[model samples]
Target: MNPELLIAFLASTAGAATPLIMASMGELVTERSGVLNLGIEGMMLVGAVVGFAVTLGTGQITLGLLAAMLAGLGMALIFAFLVLTLQTNQVATGLALTLFGIGLSAFLGRGLVGQTVDPLPHLHFPLLSDIPFVGPLLFRFDSMVYASLLLVAAIAWMLARSRLGLMIRAVGESPDSAHAIGFHVIGLRYGTVMFGGAMAGLGGAYLSLALTPMWVEGMTAGRGWIALAQVVFATWKPRGVMLGAYLFGGVTVLQFHGQGFGLAVPSEFLSMLPYLATIVVLVIICRNPQTILLNKPMSLGQNFRAD
Candidate 1:
């Protein structure tokens, strides 16, 4: 393969994977806190639309990103209230949240279709970016890519070594025990769910503000679900999440450039490559029940009532 082609492939792969890294990391923490929020797709859609609309109107990317996070935060709050406060079924509520996000975003973005905005600028280092191969590969990405990686490192370290991480893991493992031991299980779960929503929103915002710089209804194209799958693919580990995201990202980028590489595969099959790869990886992972069982959060998707 040509060096230039390899550089482009690697760069695009990192771009494609950035959103998954953000959203999956958020969901990773949420699941670790024993709450299952399936509204990520919905949240991403809302974030995408809101971010685009706001950026288009106000000409401020930062505000748009912040608004997107708040929008997602609001959605998570609703979910938290229903499942945590009212003790509603986690799965049902999550499904409802997704549906609501879809409908709400569609309504909000109705007048904003066919619009586009300037993409987030990629950071350029003066001398380093002028370097031959390493420059384009390492220094040309936007800030979000590096931020996502940093978030992963932070979460991994926290989970492995922080007191707060211990509480979150405890809540996921046994809410009753966590509650009995004087930890506020409900409060902690609320925080994690909200954090997940914000991250999902930020991921969505990235789609509009940086990746494609445009809005389309359901623009996320099931990436939210893929992010959820990635959490499991990584066995709930942050570093593993990064690896899984990049793997999926690589597959996604490949489909776009597959024909360019002289592959004779059908375009339709090429389009299906990312999703198909997801299913295949999931099936292979599920075949080993112990892999899931050992790392699975005990109280995930379960509602807890305080005694």
Candidate 2:
């Protein structure tokens, strides 16, 4: 590959991976706190529609991003209430949330279809973007891309070193013991789950406002599922999530560019490549149960009631 083309491909790969990094990191934290909220796809869809609609109506990208996060947070609150307060099944509520988000976003975005807004602007440093190759690869990207990287770093630090991190880990490992030992298990779980939802919404906002800048029903296109798989593939490690997201992001970009490179494969097959890679990764990971058991939260997906 030409050096210039290779640089562009890498840049595109980073852009493609940004949303997954943010969303999966959020889920990683949520699961660490022992809550399995599987409604990421729904959250992303609702966020995309809400973000696009708000941006279109007000012409303010900031407002659009805020609205997207709020929308996702609201959906997560619903999930938290059902699973935590009402003691409903976590898996069922999460699946229902995804269905609800799909329908609601579709309805909300009906009129906004085909409309386009300004995509998120790339941050160009003065001398940095002027540099030969390093500038384009590292210095020129939307703020969110850098933000996602920082988010990953922050989460990793918090989970590994902070007192709060230890508390969260304790809660996830043994909620009953955590509850007995002066921890507000329900409260912490609610906080983590809500955070996850906001991140998912933010990821969706990145899709509509940055990646494509338009509202399409289900634009998320199962990236949410891929994000979930990322959490598992990373074995619940924050740094691992970052790497897994980039790996998938690279695959996604490759699929789009494969035909142009004369791979001679059907476009449909190319489109399916990202998903196929996801299944393959999941299958390989599942084959090694020990890897999962080592880091997975013990109380994940369980309903907790305050005694």
Candidate 3:
């Protein structure tokens, strides 16, 4: 590949990875809090629809983004109420949430289909955008790309260095112990879940409003599932989630780029690379049950009871 093309490819890969990174990182927090929110895809779909609809109507991308985040938060609250308060099974509730998000987005976006919104503008640093190789790769990107990186850094710090992070870790490990110590387990779980939902929503908005600039049914195409797998692949680490997402993104882009370069691989087989990679990584990471148990949240997917 030409140097410029390679740089461009890397840049596009980063751009593609942004949404996955955001969603996976958010999920990292949710799972860290001992709540396995499988409804990430649903939250993302709702955000995409709401973001596009609002942006089309109001012509304000920021509002659209906020609206998407709020919608995601609402969904998270519902999930929290069902799983945390009512003690519903996390897996079932999460699956229902995904179904609900898909149906709602399809219905709500019906009238808005085929409409377009102004894509989020790209940001160019003064001197940085001019550098030969790094310039095109690092300096030229939309605002969402930068924001995604910041989120990764912030999340890593919060998880590693903050008191709240400790509380979250405590709750995930043993809500009973946390509750015994007055950590307000339920409240902490709710907060973290909402934050995760908001991040997932933002990821969806990045896809619909910024990256693609259009509405399409089920456009996320299992990226949410990939994000869930990434949390496990990373052993619940935020930095690992970022790296995993980019790796998957690179695989995804490689398929298309390969096609562009006249690779003889069948398109169907190429399309399966991301999901296949996910499964292979999972098998490797989870090969040892003891190791997985050591890293996994003790209470993950379990219903917590106050009694």
Candidate 4:
């Protein structure tokens, strides 16, 4: 591979992986508090459409990103109320949320289809950006890309060292015990759920506002599910999520780049590459029960009532 090609591939990988890292990181924290949210895909779609609409209306990507987060937060609130307050089945509620989000985004985006906006500008380091491989690889991305990396570092630090992190883990491990210790398990879960929604929304915003600067139905292309699988593949570890997201991102970029490099595989197969890889990773994870059991939140997917 040419050095230039290698650099370009790595750069694109970072761009592709940004949304996954941000969304999964939020989900990681939410899961750490023992709440299972299947609504990320829905939330992401909501964010994408809302973000695109707002940006198109205001001509400000910043405002669009903010609206996207707010839109996702709104969706999370609904989920939290159903699952956390009314005690709905977490799995069913999550699935329903995904469906709702798909429909809502499609409906909302109907007017904006085929519209385009100027893509966000990449950040440039005057002196450092010109340096060989490191410069292009590290310095050329937009603010959101760099922010996602920082978010990963920040999340890792918080989970590993912060008192809040310990409390969240305790809730996930044993909610009853955490409650007996006077912790507000339900409240914490709500907060994390909202956070995850916001991050997922931000990821969706990245897709429409930065990558393509256009609105299209189902543009997320089920990346939300990929993010969920990422959390599982990473076994709830922050760094693992980053690695898995980028690995999958590479697979995503590969199919598009593959034929260009003389890979004779058909276009249809290339498009299926990422999802197929997701299934394989999931199978590998299921095959190693210990890997999951050891790291998975003890009370994951279970609801608790204080009555």
Candidate 5:
């Protein structure tokens, strides 16, 4: 293969992986706080439709992105109310949320079929993007790619250095202990969950508004579920999530290339690469529950009672 072709391949892999990276990182935060949100798929779907619809109406990609975040946060708040306030089963509530999001998006997006929007424009740095093989591979990408990198760096800084990050970790490890230390456990959980939802929503929006630039039912496929698996694959670490996202992204990009290379594989099987990679990574990580338990939020799926 040509060197330029390899660079392009890697670039496509990163582009494909960006959404997963965003969604998985968000879920990592949520799970770190001891909340397992299974409705991620639903949240992403809602964000996709809502973001695309808003962009179509307003012709502002920024507004569309904001709308997508808000939509996702709205859905997350509903989950928070049910599981946190009403004390419902976390898993069941999450599944219900996913169902609700899917139904709502399908109903609302009927008119958006076959429509298109101007996706975010790619940013090319002077001289940097013009470099021979590395330019196309590294420098030419939309703002979302940079945002994903920034998110990873920001998350690492927060978790490793920031006071608020410590508090979040405390909340996840043991809400009771965190409460004793005067941390607003409920507030922290709610905030993190909402943030996670927004990220997931942005990830979804990236697909509809940026990647494909069109609306389709079940467009997210199982990316949300894959994102959930990524949290586990990362062992609840921010950098781990980034690596896992790229790994999955590579699988995604390779599937398309596999067909081009005429590997004689079924398209369905090729498409399963990302999900299959997710499962394999999950199994490997879960093999050491003790290590996972150490980093996992102590109260992560347990409801808190003010008593």
Candidate 6:
């Protein structure tokens, strides 16, 4: 009810939503090229561990972020090689990637467990950050938070207004047509896949280096899956993805803020709110077949092989 309270809630939602925004946005581009990557969760895990380890070893968050992206890129490259080059089942390969990421990250992170680092600092825009209601709400967040918003805006612009966006959309709709027209389908898809991997890795880094600021084996806790679902729930649109992310973030932050409002509940139930909301939203979006068909990528999840 209070403006300050609302601002705080919204701010928390932004923080909570950052990783999902990054991950889903990445998946969005990947799918825009007609490739479904179910390995997002695993990739995020790898990013988390790699990011934490690098930061721990070097005490440099920037390098840590870079390492995470590279690690995620490696994972994506493997997926692309298998599914695109080798023509493996996209779904199955994606699942394998996820499993490998989970195990590999845990194994690699074994020694780094329990260690912590200083969380990313929030940026303060002197004059702007001092404004009454707008300051903290808009100008006081870490670089990643701002970067996530900018990334969304950039993606929306690129997908809708840019020529490259048109090419990408065309490829996703019909890779055969794209290839026949002399647009290197495989090359384009590879680039998108690597970009997706990089974003997923950044999401993982945000988790370890910002949100929790520590390495806990499998710290992602299914957020990657939620991000994947977000892409579908958003119907492959960047605007929709951002909205869904914040709404989901709100659900996530509610449990923490509930106690202050005297909304007493079991901790377990409170913790389940976010995931529960996710299932509910998915069912809502999925129940209507027309909605799915209206915006669904025609060639999504299908392998494109040049004959």
lDDT tens digits, residue span 96-161, model 3: 999999999899989987888999998989999999898888888998999999999999899889
Q: How well is each residue in 1-307 modelled by candidate 5, as lDDT tens digits?
A: 6565577668888888899988998898888888889999999999999999999999999999999999999999999988888889999999999999999999989999999999888999999999988788788999999899899999889987999899988888888888987899888889989999999999999999878888998899989999988887777889988988898889888877875555799888989878887778777767888866657776778888666
lDDT of 1 by residue, 104-182 (tens): 9999999988889999999999999889999998999999999999999999988879999999999999999999899
Model 6: per-residue Cα lDDT over 1-307, one tens digit each: 6787788888999999999999999999999999999999999999999999999999999999999999999999999999899999999999999999999999999899789999889998879999999999899999999999899999999999998988889899999999999888898899899999999999999999998999998889899999999998999999999999999999888888877656779878988988998899889988999886777779999999898
Tens-place lDDT digits, model 2, residues 259-280: 5555788878878888999899
TM-score computed on alpha carbons, candidate 1 = 0.98
Q: C-alpha displacement of 9 in model 4, angstroms?
A: 1.7
Give the per-residue Cα lDDT of candidate 4 at 70.
96
* Stretches of model 2 off by over 4 angstroms after superposition: none
Structural RMSD, model 2: 1.0
Against the true structure, what is each candidate's TM-score?
Answer: 0.98, 0.98, 0.97, 0.98, 0.97, 0.97
In candidate 6, the residue pairs with backbone N, CA or C atoms under 3 Å apart (3 or more residues apart, or in different chains) clash, namely: none
Error of 6 at 78 (Å): 0.6
In model 1, pairs of residues that clash are none
Better of 4 and 5 by TM-score: 4
Supply the TM-score for candidate 3.
0.97
RMSD of each: 0.9, 1.0, 1.1, 1.0, 1.3, 1.2
lDDT of each: 0.92, 0.92, 0.90, 0.92, 0.89, 0.93
Across residues 1-307, which tens digit of lDDT does each residue of candidate 4 receive?
A: 6788788878888888998888899899999899999999999999999999999999998999999999999999999999999999999999999999999999999999999988878999998999999999988999998898889999999988999999999999999999999999899999999999999999998999987789889988989999999999999999999999899889888876786577899988988889999999999889978987778999999999986
Q: List, in order, the clash count of every candidate structure.
A: 0, 0, 0, 0, 1, 0
